[model samples]
Target: MRKCRFAPGGIYHIYNRGVDKREVFISESDYIRFLCSLYRFNDIAPTSNLHRIAYDVRGLTSNISDKPDKRKRLVNILYYALRPNHFHMTLQELIEKGIEKFMQKIGTGYTMYFNKKNKRSGALFQGTFKAIAIESERYLMEISRYIHLNPLKNIEPEFREKGVENIDKAKDFLLHYKWSSFLDYVSIKNFPLLINNEIHKGYFKDASQHKDFVFEGLFEVKPRTCKGIL
Candidate 1:
C-alpha cells in the first residue's frame, strides 16, 4: 500500500489495479457498469440488487442515474480516473471509515460483476486498494492533476515521463475522455452526479480556469517534479 490512514475529513488518493495488472475495464459496457457502480455503491445505505439496477433492460447505465439525490455519501468523490487496467480517485472522507466503506463496496461489487460476466473466479483486484493521504492543499491539486492526466497513457504510453509532445492534442484527448472527472471539473458535464465539485469553489474561479490549470499548468511541470505525485 502507498500510505494508510482513514480519518474523517481527511482527503486520500485511492487506487488499485487488476490481479496480475490485467485489464479491469474491457469494453464500453464494462466501463459504464463500473461508473454506475461508483454511483450506486457510494452511499451509507446498503446497495440492494447491485448492478442489476444499473443494467436493466430499458437502459445500460442510465437506469442507475434515476436514483434519488438524497442518499448520504460515505465520501465526497473529489476526482477520479479509470484507466484500462487500474483506477484512481481522490476522496474527502465525510464520516468514520468513509473511504474504507466506499472502496470495499466498489471493489467487491465490481469484481462480482466482472467475474460473473467474464466466466472467471477468485479475487479480481490486487490485495487491496492503496491510499495516499493528501496532507496539504497544494498536494491535493497535484494529486488530482496526476489522476486526470492518467489518460495520456492511452494516447502515448510515455507522456507521463517525457511530457506531452503536442499540448493541444493532449488537451483535446483529455477533454473528450468520458471516464474521468476532468470533464466534470471543467464544467463540461461528464458525470456531474458522481462528483462533489463544491470543493473547487474557492480554488478556481470557473471551469476554463481549471481547464487551464489541468492542461497548461501540468504541461510545464517537468516530469521529475511530478515524481511523488505520479
Candidate 2:
C-alpha cells in the first residue's frame, strides 16, 4: 500500500480490486449492494438471515461516521463505476481523513456481509484501497469524466472507440445505472441519506456545462496515469 495525503476539501481518485482476480461483483445485485454502501455509509443494513446461515462472519458494524459531533458531512462522491473485479470513485473530502474513514467503514461492513452471503471467509479486497489526489481543477474535471465514462466502455464500446460522440446517450445510461453517483452529479436524483450535497454540487457549474466539458475531452484529452503516491 502507498501513503496518501489526507487533505481536507481535496478531490481524490480512489480505487481497489478484489482478492486475486476474483469477481468483486458477481451479479447486478452484488454491484447494487456495493453502490448502496457507498452512499449509505454508516447506515448499512444487516445481512439477511439466509446470509447468516451460509458462513461464519466477523467485524460487522454500522457504516456511520466516527466523528459524531462534526457539523458538516465529509467525503462527497463525485462519480463512481462498479466493475466486475474492481471499482473506482472520485470524491471530494469534506473533512480530514474523510475518504480514509469512509472507505474503512464500508470495507469492514461489506466484508462481513459478503462472507456470510457467499459462504466465504478471510479478506475480500487485495489490501488497503488506493487513492490519487487530483491536484488541479483541470485534473479534477477530467478525472471525474473518466470515472463516469468507465461503464460506457462496457455498454457502448464502439462509441467510446470513436471518441465521446454519443456521450449524451452515455450520460443517460449513467443516470439509469443505479450503482453510480453520476445521477447525483447531473441532478437527476438525490440520495442525501448517503451522499453530501454541498460538496457534490461544488464539482460543477451546471449539468449542461459539465456535459459539454466531458464531451470536449473525448477528442482532445491526453491519457494520464498515476503510480504510487499522489
Candidate 3:
C-alpha cells in the first residue's frame, strides 16, 4: 500500500489493477456493473446493496437513471476511467476519510459481487489501491489527459510512451469509449450527475478545445513528464 494521507478539499489520483494484471471487466455487463457501483457506492451513509439491487433487477438496463439520493458525498469524483484490467479516478475528498471510505465501499462491494458471479474466490485486486496526491494545476490537467487516454492502449500498446499512432482513430475510439468519463468531460453528458466538473470546466474553453488538448496536447508532452506524479 502506498503511504499517503488524504485531506479534505485535496485532489488525488486513485487507481487499482486486477490481480496478476488479469481482466477485471470480462463483459459488457461487467463493465456496466462496475460503473453502477461507482455511482451507487459514493455515499457517506450506508445505502442499499448494489449487488442485491442488481440481482433483484437482473436483465434490466444498467443505465442508472434515478437521481443520486440526497446525502453528503464521501468524495467528489472529478474524473474517472475504467480500463480492461484496472480503473482510474481523480477525486477531491469532501470530508474526513472520504476517499478511504468511498474506495472501501466500491472495492469490497465489487470484489464480492465479482467473485460470486464468476464462482471464484480469493482477492480480486493486486493489493491495497494506490493513491497519489495531485500537487499542481498542470499536474491535474495532465493527469486527466493521461487517464482519459488510457483506452488508447488497446490499439497502441505504447501510446503512452510514444503518443498515438493514428490520431484520427485514437480520437474516434476515445469519443466512443463508454467506460470512461471522457465523454462527460467533453460535454457529451454520459453521466453528468456523477461528476463535479466545475473544477475542470474553466480549464478548457469548450469541448472541442478539450478534445484537441487530449489528442494533440498529449503529443507535445514529453513521455517522462507525461507519466505524471502517479
What is the lDDT, from 0 to 100, of the residue 221 in candidate 1? 44
For 115-173, candidate 2 gives per-residue lDDT tens digits of: 87799999999899988877886777667777666666566654444665565776677
Model 2 earns a TM-score of 0.71
lDDT of 2 at 99: 79
TM-score quality measure for candidate 1? 0.91
Q: Which run of 10 residues does model 3 get worst, by summed lDDT?
A: 54-63
Pick out the ten consecutive residues of candidate 1 with the lowest summed lDDT.
54-63
lDDT for predicted candidate 1 compared with the true structure: 0.80
Which tens-of-lDDT digit does each residue in 102-212 have in candidate 1? 889999889998999999999998888888888887888777777888888898777766767888888888989988989888878667777887777778899888877
Query: What lDDT would each prediction earn against the true structure?
Result: 0.80, 0.63, 0.80
Off by over 4 Å in 3: 54-68, 217-222, 226-230
Looking at model 1, the pairs that clash are none
Best by TM-score: 1
Q: All candidates: CA RMSD in angstroms?
A: 2.3, 6.6, 2.8
Q: After superposition, how far is residue 35 of candidate 2 from its true place, in Å?
A: 2.9
Looking at candidate 2, the ten consecutive residues that score lowest on lDDT are 53-62
